[model samples]
Target: MRGAILPADSDQAVLAGRLDLGEGPTPVLIRGGMVEDVSAAAPTVSDLLERDDPAAVRGRPLFAAAELADRGPLLAPVDLQAIKACGVTFAVSAIERVIEEAARGDMDAAAAVRGRLEARVGAGIRSVVPGTPEAASLKAALVEDGMWSQYLEVAIGPDAEVFTKTAVLASVGWGAEIGVRSDSGWNNPEPEIVLVTNSKGRIAGAALGNDVNLRDFEGRSALLLGKAKDNNASCAIGPFIRLFDDGFTMDDVRAAELDLVIEGPEGYRLDGHSSMVQISRDPEELVRQARSEHHYPDGFALFLGTLFAPVQDRDEPGRGFTHKVGDVVTISTPKLGTLVNRVTTSDRAPAWTFGIGALMRNLAERGLLDIGGGAGDGHD
Candidate 1:
C-alpha cells in the first residue's frame, strides 16, 4: 500500500511529507526511495518549504519508502499551512455549480436542470477565457436569456473564487477515512491538485487532494459553503508533496492529468478524469487571486479546482451520484501518485484533535523548536 501511494517515479521525484511517530507530526523527505526524518532541518512543513531548496535539505535516516506501511500513519504532509481552494475553474465544474444552484440542492431536480443548462450555455462557457471581453459578453448573453448565475459570474469574471477549505491540521492523509456530512443527501469527492506554497506565495510543490464536498448544502445557499466544506476529516491531501525540481516543475503541473476511481461497498464503480489543460483559469492565475488581499503567514495549500463532476446516476435515473459509506476513493496521477481513502460520515470519522496548539507543544517537547537555519544551512 505504501509503494502504491508513492509517485510512480518515486526514485526520481523529490518528495516531502509528514508522519506521526506516536508523538506528533514529523517532517520527512523521500529522496531516492528513502524516508529521512528532517525535524532537525525544519520542525514543520511550513518551515521546510520556506527554504530556497527543500529537496536539498537532509536529516537522519528513518526507513526505506517501502517500509512506510509498517511505520506510523502518514499525515496530510502539511502543518501550520493554510488550506485554501478555488472553485468554478473548469467549464464542466462551473456548469455543475450552476445546476446545483438552479436545482436548489434537490438531487432529483439536478438531472433536469443539468440537461437544460448544458444545452443552453456549455459551449460558450468552454470557449471563452476567464476575465476576458468574450467572457463578459457571454455573461451578458446569459443574463439576457435569464440564465445568469453567480457561479457563472465567478466562472468568467476577472476574480477567481478562492476560499478557506479547512483549518490547519484538519486534513487527513492517504489511507485515512475521508468524511461527508452525515445529513448530506448529495455529495461527492472533488479530486484536485493542491499547490503547496510559502508565505511569499511561491508554489513550492503539488499534491493530490480530495476536497470532499456536499452539493446540497452549497446548492441550497452559497452561504452554506462553510458547512458544506469544513467537516471533520473532510479534506484529504497526501501521500506526499512532490517538490518541484529540475525534472519536475510548474510546466508539469500545467500538463498534469488526474484520474479518479470510487468503488462502493455495494459493488458500485465510478471512474472520472480531469485534465489540467482544460481548466478555465491557469494555476498561477488562481494563486495570484488567492494572495490578492489575504496573507498566509504559515503558507497555504491551494486546491486547483477539478474538471470532473459526477453526474452519473447512482440509484434512480434522475438522481445523480452521491457517496455511500465505505466507498473507497482513489485519486491518482503518475507524477503525484495516489491518494486513497475510505468514506465515512463526518460524525463517524475520527475527530480532529491535533491542531496548531498541539503541534507547538509537541515540537517544544521534542526539543525541535529552537532550530534556526535557512535553506542551505542543513544538508548532507
Candidate 2:
C-alpha cells in the first residue's frame, strides 16, 4: 500500500494517508482515497511502520489522498536533527569530478584525484579485514600518500544546512553572498534518493531529495567541500516518506527507479535518471559511516548519493551549468511522490571586511547574527 504525509487542510498540522492505489496491496484501512490522519491511530511515520504487521494494528480506519485541500507539498518528510550526504557513489560521478577539476586548469591535482578514485574503486573489490594482505597493502598506501586525499564525499550535519522551503536563500550575514562564487557562480542541482531513519539509525522510510551544491566553492579547494555543500538551503528532502517493513531490503529499494529534471524559464535545463544499483556503496553502509563518529539524538536523514549528474565534457564548450533564480527542480518516483522546489537568490552577498567585528556588525545589520552565539550564527 502507498500513501502521502500531508498538512491538514483546516490547520497547518502535518498528517498522512494510505493512498487508494486501486488494485495493489491491501492497506490497513480503506476510507475513500486515503487513510486520513494515519497518525490518529499511529502517531509518527515510524510508529506506523512498527505497527504495520497485519496481526498487530489491523482494522484501523483509512481515508483517501484526494480528500485534502489543494496546497503545494512540503519538502521535508519528518523531524530530523541532521542530514548526511554521500558522494562519488556512482562511477559517472567520479568521471564528472575528474573532468570538472581538470577544466579548472589543475591537471596534477586532477590526476591525483583520479588516482584516489582508482584506489577507492579497487579497494571496494578488496576485503578490508585486518591482517589480510589487501588490508595491509591498502593501509600502507594511504600512509605513504602523506595526507593526500580526494572528494570521496561527506555527510553535512547541523540543521542550518537543511531546507524545506521552495526557494533557496543565500545570506550575506553568514558568509553567503552572490559575488563570493569561484568560477561562474553557476550551481547545479542533484536529484537523489533519500533515506529517513529513526533515533537508533534504523531505516524507516524513503523519500526524494536534492543535494544542492556550489561548483565554484568545490573548484577552489577540495577540502572546502563542507563549505561548498553545507550552507543554508543546501539540502532538501520530502514531499513525504515511503515506508518499509522488516520484510523490505536494500535490494528491493535499489530495484526502484529514480529520475530528476531541472527546468528554467526557457525550457528544460537538465534531465537524467538512474538506479541505486549504480551506487558504489550500499545505503546501509553510508548511514553506518555517517553515524560512526557523530550522535544524532533527534534522528537523521541521508542523501544516498546521486547518479548520472550532468558533466561538462572538454569538447562541449557551452553546456549550461548552475541553477538560477526562477528555476524549478524535481525528483520523482512512483513509490515516493515528486519533490519540487523553486530556486531563489538571496538579496545579500558576502563582502570583504577588515576584521571579525565588522563581519559581526554586517550580520547584525541584516538581523542575521545570533546573539551569544546561539541560532544567530548558523555556522557548521
Best by lDDT: 1
Separately for all candidates shown, the number of backbone clashes (residues 3 or more apart, or on different chains) is 0, 11
Listed per candidate, the RMSD to the true structure in angstroms reads: 3.1, 11.7
lDDT agreement with native, every candidate:
0.91, 0.49
The regions of model 2 sitting more than 4 angstroms off are 1-32, 38-63, 67-69, 102-149, 152-184, 246-248, 312-320, 346-380
Tens digit of per-residue lDDT, candidate 2, span 272-328: 786877665667777777776565554566777677655442222454366666666
TM-scores of the candidates are 0.96, 0.60
Model 2 backbone overlap count: 11
Model 1: per-residue Cα lDDT over 1-380, one tens digit each: 33387888989998999998777788999988798999987899999999888988988998899888666457999888899999989999999999999999999999889889999998999999999999999999999999999999999999999889999889999889999999999999999999999887889999999999999999999999999999999999998999998888999999999999999999999999999999998999899889887767778899999999999999999898999999999999999999989999999999889888888888899898965543334321
